[model samples]
Target: MHDDRHAPRKGAIPTHALKAAQEIVVLKWRRTSFKRLDGSIDVLDDDWSLSIGGRSLARIYLLNGGPQDGRWAWFVQVFPEGTPGNGGVGVDDDGRAAREACESLLPPAIQQALADGRKSETN
Candidate 1:
């Protein structure tokens, strides 16, 4: 019998190179508007992927609100690398991917805002 724990899971890709690239692949979709308690909201469909260590490490999906004009929700997927059975870090990895993807999808001005947020957190 195969020990699933020891076996490398499918779809696992090394992400070191992709992370080093510092460039993300961005996919954009049409925007949608909705009503919110606070006000009206617009959501955009944007997806992004990061390559690391010559492999694809993670992918992100962004849904940002308009009217409010900010991020409302995000979806992220992380592939396995350097881990047994291609396990995933789920919430943390997804959150990071989402944030990064969202930034990639933003306009120049909004992208600046995302960058600033990152800087503030680090400092």
Candidate 2:
């Protein structure tokens, strides 16, 4: 019998790479909170992850922000999970406008992480 421990769990993104991709992947929301330890307490948001074939590609969150015209909510810190990249792709207005932004962002982010991992393996 095959073990199911390695199988992806709900709201959990596999940080480890998988053998192959099987279907249309998406980002799943996870509980998020922000605390201050000398930093701003206003930083808070809901977190989400994009996983493919049980492997995490990127992580994003809707950040708390002030009103600016018709915008307020911001999706910032688009970074690869597990290793290498520790910064964001860029900040964008959350909700409808941000959807396509992430769609375009995921592929390249995952590819870069995978490449970085491979490079590290050779060193």
Superposed model 2: Cα runs more than 4 Å off:
1-19, 22-45, 65-88, 108-123
TM-score of 2: 0.35
In terms of lDDT, the poorest run of 10 residues in model 1 is 83-92
How many residue pairs clash in model 2?
Answer: 0
Maximum-lDDT candidate = 2
Candidate 1 global lDDT: 0.40
- How well does each candidate superpose onto the true structure, as a TM-score? 0.29, 0.35
Off by over 4 Å in 1: 14-48, 53-56, 59-69, 79-123
